[model samples]
Structures are given as structure tokens and as C-alpha cells.
Target chain A: DVKVTQSSRYLVKRTGEKVFLECVQDMDHENMFWYRQDPGLGLRLIYFSYDVKMKEKGDIPEGYSVSREKKERFSLILESASTNQTSMYLCASSSTGRNQPQHFGDGTRLSIL
Target chain B: AQRVTQPEKLLSVFKGAPVELKCNYSYSGSPELFWYVQYSRQRLQLLLRHISRESIKGFTADLNKGETSFHLKKPFAQEEDSAMYYCALSGQSDSWGKLQFGAGTQVVVTP
Candidate 1:
């Protein structure tokens, strides 16, 4: 079974603070993604990395950046968090194949005060 | 722009009743569709994909290209089947790893 582990199940951060959400996958997938899940908005992509040091902006990449220094780990960074940034963050990984289904982590519920 | 639309936010049914969750998509080219389920306190998992044409957990979905819909259906609803279902689409020209998802439907099966 594939395992996608998130560093935090719940997180709290203050406004204007830097925040990091980490995700690690054991399946050695080549594609990793960061998404924010919101009510009525579904899961909107924030950023994705196809390979180490290669990143692309998704539909909602503003105020967020991602790091993929290694194949197994992907990190989402919020340089300065705000209350609007509070949402359930999910990390997913998939093989390079076109039709491969993504495996998702348990998600981190972020709260910005 | 590609988009996935799941119109229902919540659906309730009896344990033995049939269930259906509707999903529609707007894409210019051929796209891959998927149904994902998230059980309470569990990670989101893939239920099925259109390309596979296989039924999972007693549920099946058929892709209708004319209508651009992929509605999930089950003959008998079970309490254990209650979960949040999300419809997702891929296969955009430039975005391979990106999936556009719908708002999701919360299914509640009453006993």
C-alpha cells in the first residue's frame, strides 16, 4: 500500500508568520502536488513539482511557494500567513504515467489567527 | 479552461435505496475522469477511474461524452458507504499532474 504522510494533522499560525507544511511519500512517485481544500470550492491546486527543483504554479498559487529538494519530500511554504490562508491543505503524489491516480495524505487543517 | 462540476453538496438516502451522484465536466479534448471518496477521518482515496471501466465497492460510473457527465450509481446504499465523494478530471494539454475537482457531495445513508 502507498503511504503519504503529512507532517502535521493540525496546525495553527499567527498572521504575518511564516508557515511550512511538509509531505512525504514512500511510493517514490515522480509527481507531487499541493492543494487547498475549502468548503464549496473543492480542492484547488496551489503548486506542483514534477521533479526535483522543478515547480509549476497551479490555479491558486498566490501567496504560496513549494520546495521539492528531494524525490520523497514536498514542502509548501507560506512566506507570511494570513487569516484567508486558513484551509485544509492536502498533499498528493502520483506516478509519471498519464492515467495514474494520485495518492493523498491525511491532510493538515491549518488555522491562521 | 477545464472544470468539473458536482451539483449536489449533500444527498441522503435509506439503507436499501439506490444512490446516484452527478458529475459533469467541461473540457475541449478527451479527458480522464475519476471518482474519489474520503471516509470520516481517513485520507482521500480513489474509488474508480473512467478509463478502467470497473466497478468498485458496489458502485459504478459511466462516462457520457455527449452530455459530458460521469454519474456514480449504486443499486443498494449501505451505511458504511457514507462518505464525501469528489469528482475530478485530468488530461489538460499542459497540466499533466493537475486535477480539477468539483465541490464534492456528502452522502448520508440512514439505517
Candidate 2:
């Protein structure tokens, strides 16, 4: 089974503070994704990394960025945390295959004060 | 651009009753649809996919290309069936392993 682990389950930060959310996958998957899940909006992709040192912008990438220095780890960075940026952050990983399912972490509920 | 839509925000059903969760999508190319379930305190996981045509935990979804819908159906609901269900659409031609997710439907199965 694929295990996707998020570094934190809950987080609190003040506005304008720099925030980092870490994710690690043990399955050696080639794809990693970061998403912000909100009520009534479901899950919106923030950033995705297909390989080490490579990243792509997702649907909502204005305030967020991602880094994949290592293949098994992907980190999401909030340049300046804001109240609107607070949400449940989810990390997912999937192996390269046809119709492969992405394994998700438990998620991190972030609160920006 | 592709979009996934789940019309119902919440669905309530009694144990042993049938349940159906509707999902619709607007995509130009060939679409791959999937159902994901997030139980309380658990991570979101794939329940079933249209390509698999297989049932999981007594839940099944059929893709209707003509109607652009993939609705999940369960013949008998159980208390454990209560969860947040999300319908997703994958764009095979445009991207890899990226999915468009619906807002999700919260299902409550009471005894």
C-alpha cells in the first residue's frame, strides 16, 4: 500500500509569516501534488511536481509554491500566510501508470491568524 | 477546461436503503471518472473508477458519455457508508495523474 505522510496534522501561523508544509511518500512514486481543500470548493490543486527539481503550477498557485529537492519528498511553501490561505492542505502521490490512483495524506488544517 | 460537478451537497439514507450520488462533468476529450471517499479522520481514498468497472464496498459507478455523467450507486446502505464522496475527472490527453474534483457530497446513513 502507498503511504503518503504529511508533516503536520494541524498548524497555526500569523499573517505575513512564512509557512512550510512537508509531505513524504514511501512508494517511490513519480508524481506528487499539493492541494488546498475548502468547504463547498472541494480540493483545488496548488502545485505539482513530477520529478525532482521540476514543478508545475496548478489551478490555484497564486500564493503557494512547491519544492521537490528529493524524489520522495515534496514541500509546499506559503510566501506570506494570510487568513484566506488557511485551509486543509493535502498531499498526494501516484505512480506513473494508466488510471493510477493518487494516495493522499491525512491533511493539515491550517489556521492563519 | 474540464469541470466536475456534484449536484447534491448532502445525501441522507437509512440503513438497508438504496443510495445514489450523482456526478456530472464537462470535458471535451475522453474523460476518466473516479469516486473517492473520505471517512471521518481518514485520508481520501479511491472507492472506484469508471475504467475499472468494479465495485468497492458495494458501491459502483457507471459512466454515461452521452449524458456526461458518472453517478455512484449502492444497492444497500450501511452505517459505514457514511462519508464524503468526491467525483473526479481525469484528462488523459492534457495531463498525467492530474484530476479535476467535484465539491463532494456528504452521505449520512442512519440506522
Q: Per-residue lDDT for A1-113 in model 2, tens only?
A: 88999999999999999999999999999999999999899999999888999999999999888899999999999999999998999999998754999899999999999
Per-prediction DockQ comes to 0.67, 0.70
Candidate 2 - chain A - TM: 0.98
TM-score for all models, in order of appearance: 0.98, 0.98
Q: Model 2 off-target regions past 4 Å?
A: none
Candidate 1 residue pairs that clash: none
Question: CA lDDT of A91 in candidate 2?
Answer: 99
Candidate 1 lDDT over residue span A1-113, tens digit each: 99999999999999999999999999989999999999888899999999999999999999999999999999999999999999999999998765789999999999999
Flag regions of model 1 displaced more than 4 Å: B92-95
